[model samples]
Target: MPGSEHADRTEDGLSIPRHRVLVTGATGLLGRAVYKEFHNNKDWHALGTGHRRARPRFLRCDLLDEDAVKAVIRDFRPDVIVHCAAERRPHVVERNAEAAVDLNVKATATLAKEAAASKPGAFLIYISTDYVFDGRDPPYGEDDTPEPLNLYGKSKLDGEREALRHCPAVAILRVPVLYGEVEHVEESAVTALWDQVQEGAAGSCMLDHCQQRFPTEVRDVAVVCRALAERQRQDPSSVRGIFHYSAKEQMTKYEMAVAIAQAFHLPASHLMPLTEQPAGAGARRPLNAQLACCRLRQLGLDVQPRPFRTAITDCLWPFLPDKRWRQTVFF
Candidate 1:
């Protein structure tokens, strides 16, 4: 019934059928990229849903509120729903377990249910994390058993289960550390390394060298999401189940810091790599949860990642105190 409405016209005033894409947590790092990707695509119309930071283009909706979520789905009737809203912070999830479950698990279930009940039954893409796998044995495949190290990972795993349970056609995408355009450097784990690099420049600073992370770019993940959405749109049963999408490049926090220092031409003599994990932490982190991109590659999707050195430098350029240095290094 939703598709019976008059089709929108393209630039040439030719009628073009468009897929309605709804992205949750549009204000967040990955959500922003996903929203932008769909918004820019000529084949689809994107509507981003956010809470605190909701803007003119984004719809303001608190995911925790079941009524609000149902209303959003019922009204929009999106053909594809990219669910990115969740309590992703490990320490924060540890601090507030109830809130994490409510947002991560309950909200996901509600969204999946609402999407499934929609007129055309929207294809859902649930954004998960590599933390679902305990860093014991990796790279983890699609069917690999998930053993979460912390509550954050467990919550995400639970969210994935909820999404799959309600919507069988859901695509669960698990990614590692993400970096991209950010309102602030502290927003992303990889970009936050610049702060550590700055700290190291002044005095002795230690970063985790033990844990290996495949830092994937948000824009790349957005592309993957778009591809998956297109695949699902073409054939509903084609894209389903768990999918791992991550960068091939591997680097520890210490290594990332070193790279940041080198890019900014800062002194790295004071930087030290901690070989062992710190004691008495709020939540335990995986040593290395390298996600295998076998499923994505097999699907003929572009799993290749941008070069870390060049990408990271470009991402951090705006934050550089001196703009003159960018003309020489970046330009």
Candidate 2:
């Protein structure tokens, strides 16, 4: 295979076959990063699927359709399947419980079944969330038992179960709040605070001192996913099972707002910290979701995530070329 050094060589010792990788939800925030990572890498042929948004590089596939999922796997015959499609919005899941169940759990189950039958060495990589931990503890390890707080977390936990049940040797990456260059910052929870800090606008930020979290970069998560795929090609056994990946430092929403305002040169005086819960919230969240990554580093993946302060530029990226503190409006 393209990822393996043991492949048959040509006259000059160049491998002929290339690794095939399929990434679902290609147009989404994190999915876009993962697909781009595989596409830019020369050793793999990356194919991605999209739903509402269509493009030449993307294959339009509705994950909810079991037949569509089967057709894509059978035709592409991918060596690795990165399942990233899910109904992630907490309030949306609360309102549309059936839709969440169909997409988050049922679709994942469909993909796992197809991947298992397609090839013996086919690897199923499911992207999970740290919300599986009810934020009651700190620095949760890989073996920590999950106690989700809301529907979104519950759905993801159910997805994990389905993935493991169908594809016994699946690799799961449970991550925290991800921020990266996307169509809109709202795709990420923490980065979306930039929107709230509008010019001369006053807003109340929750004094969520008890609820601690880390904002991980989507690009960083993508790097780890690609590394796992490469390692799987070499030794499938090593990459199997659940793995945790997140930012190095954890901060509460209140603390993060202060830093975010400083980075964007916004006023914190108006962004008052309120101890009471924010109004119109349908779901309860984990108070502390800090993912531990010691095991991932031990695997020799060479994935060292950037610090929150240094990665601020990475979160805004090409949109705001000059990352210095500037009084500017970000949509």
Candidate 3:
């Protein structure tokens, strides 16, 4: 069986079988990074699943459909299932709470059940959010009890429980706001600030300065996910239960805007900071939800994330409107 240790043999003296990995939400920002990490690694054969925007290298599957999820799991017979699909937008989740539950909790539950019932029992990793913490405290450890403030956070917490309920050998990774290579500037919340910066350059712009956020890079999170998969292959019992991964830098959205303006060589005099949550928001967010990464650090994985300024500059470079302006600023 492909799931077994002796599935494939190599020419080298120490032969290792290449495991098949199935990634969900391949088209999304973070999902794309995760799929790329595993797809590029020679140790694993990866197949990604997506909906609406599905294309080559990814199999189209609506996770909400139990039958479709079952078919993918049964046919792919993955040794590892990385569940990254979810209604991640807090406002969107608020608009239709039912739909959020369906995708976040119900769909995750279905995937976990199918993975557990597979012939070899695929190890499942459910990507979660740091929003599970209420943000009242700093450096939340793995064992810390979650106290989510909004529907999105609550739903993700519930998804974690459901995934664990159906699959005992599940690993839950809770990450914070992520930014990385984007198809467009608005694809990621961090990169999206570039638009606001540009708008602020035109006139005054108000940004959230009260809530402290640790914006992590999607590529960094992808690396950690790959490391966990590799650890599971080496020792099935080594990677299980709840874990946390995040960047160490701390800054508010207002500060982030300032950084973005500086990075792109734009004016920030028009930018304003709102120390309180914006009025009429769809949902209430935590003031700070810093996740402690003691576990991953102890596991010998890279816990130090790239500097925010360096990463954000690289991430927004591709979307720069004027090629000559980009050359003038960067060069």
Candidate 4:
């Protein structure tokens, strides 16, 4: 309830009364942000779950295990369940299809069904990805038909379908690359680059790939999720379907690298450019995965209008002091 007063004054406002909420994937980057956003609300009781380590109120739970998930649903009886857990590495999913299915698709389906049965009016928000599209087009809207190119996208699409089928009140939020600071492993793109520069490597830069994308910051997504959760509590019949949430501007990976270098006063010359090519023998990536957020804005969500450079700089502020870097190179 720390930011409740401000959170309550949003467009949809706090429509639902006080109730307990459950946040899965509480230890992940975006999940941690969401947990922080809702943790202090006096009106709503916030309980979270992590796969291994215990967060403040988090209970140990592996979402892939249906019995464990069902037990959480029965015990917590949350009014709102925000599902942010998933196996996101594309090649990893490609290599281990069954684990991906078990965790991303099966676990999500289990949670959705249990939430629907346990709490009739509960709202279930599934965090999905913009990679669900084939990326033939540059900017994709909410209603645009998805043509997923890989196993990761296929599995998430499957989860989305399952959520819609079982949960009457569900919000499938498709977001793009989530960047933020949590642990060393959870550092943002900007942070990763800054670490490289601090390590005395010629500052790093991405190749001039034509690929464009709408990157969603971890904090911003958390804010929207909390807002939507409140709205669902207020009006169960409001609306239900896919919602795109991301920064308004589209930025190429190279442009993003330049911005990160500038944030720390590094010379652009220090950054190297690499062409688009397969890393090792993995899946080919989409050249353009930008998302359109008009529907979310129409619904009164605050979409940041600045360019991605500004957003990247903001996300990099906290991690500059760490001064660490990864030697693994990618284009």
Per-candidate TM equals 0.95, 0.88, 0.94, 0.84
Best by lDDT: 3
TM-score attained by model 1: 0.95
lDDT of 4 by residue, 235-327 (tens): 666648889887765666556666666655655665555565545547555677778877677778755544655666656655555334211
Clash-forming residue pairs, model 1: none
Question: Mind giving the per-residue lDDT tens digits that candidate 3 earns over 1-331?
Answer: 3444444665675444478889999899989999999988867778899998887668899999999999888888998899999999999999999999999999999999999999779999999999998999877999999999899999999999999999977999999999999988888888888888888537798888999999999999999999998898788887999999999889999999999889788889888999877677768888889988878888897557999989999898887788998899888
Local distance difference test values of all predictions, in order: 0.88, 0.81, 0.89, 0.74
- Count clashes in each candidate, considering only residues at least 3 apart in sequence or on different chains: 0, 2, 0, 5
Runs in model 4 deviating more than 4 A are 1-17, 55-57, 185-190, 195-208, 278-281, 305-318, 321-331
The alpha-carbon deviation from the true structure for residue 41 of candidate 4, after best TM-score superposition, in angstroms, is 2.8
Please estimate how well model 2 matches the true structure, expressed as its whole-model Cα lDDT. 0.81
lDDT of 3 at 250: 94
* Model 3: ten consecutive residues of lowest lDDT: 1-10
User: Cα miss at 193, model 4 (Å)?
Assistant: 3.2
Ranking by TM-score: 1, 3, 2, 4
Off by over 4 Å in 1: 1-17
Tens-digit lDDT track of model 2 for 104-155: 9999999988988986546999999999998777778889999999999999
